[model samples]
Target: MDGAIWASAYGCQGKAVASSAFGRPSGELQARADSPTPAGIRQRSGAEMIMGQGAVPIIVGGEVVGACGVGGGPSEDAEACAAG
Candidate 1:
């Protein structure tokens, strides 16, 4: 990919440090942290995880494989792009 594209995508630019780590979509995680469900509260995960919709975790065989982050558009659009 070209530098321009890389820079535009959140994680593609060697920026989404949690690329090596694995977990739910950052938005969900962030939401839980911000205002957890009635049954339970959550602790802060880390800085690498962000509070947005562009990140999509790549899972295989029930295991986290990698991730994709598309950041040049709205939340739904970017999320769809990454999922594809």
Candidate 2:
């Protein structure tokens, strides 16, 4: 999958965000809301979520082939970068 992370002090956070993308259709914000667990989906999945944005499915031919995660600051900027 094509993705990029900018200036994250926690290296794993970037990977976590990217990987989390594949698990859901909505971004992190919605992910938390849709979580069936109380500890939250990320915690259940064994990753600490620092931010709530960026990361989306790369759909092709009506199927999700991969994902794109542009994690940096706010969800909007990251999302825009990913979309860009």
lDDT of 2 by residue, 1-84 (tens): 134354543533543354344544235554454455523655665654433456555677877666556554666676666667
Stretches > 4 Å off in candidate 2: 1-34, 37-45, 48-51
C-alpha lDDT values of all predictions: 0.51, 0.52
What TM-score do all the candidates reach, one by one? 0.56, 0.51
What digit string (tens of lDDT, one per residue) describes model 1 on residues 1-84? 322454465443222333325355544444444444411322234334444666677788988877776665565666667678
Off by over 4 Å in 1: 1-7, 11-22, 33-46
Which residue pairs clash in candidate 2?
Answer: none
Q: Least lDDT summed over 10 consecutive residues: which range in candidate 2?
A: 9-18
Clashing pairs in 1: none
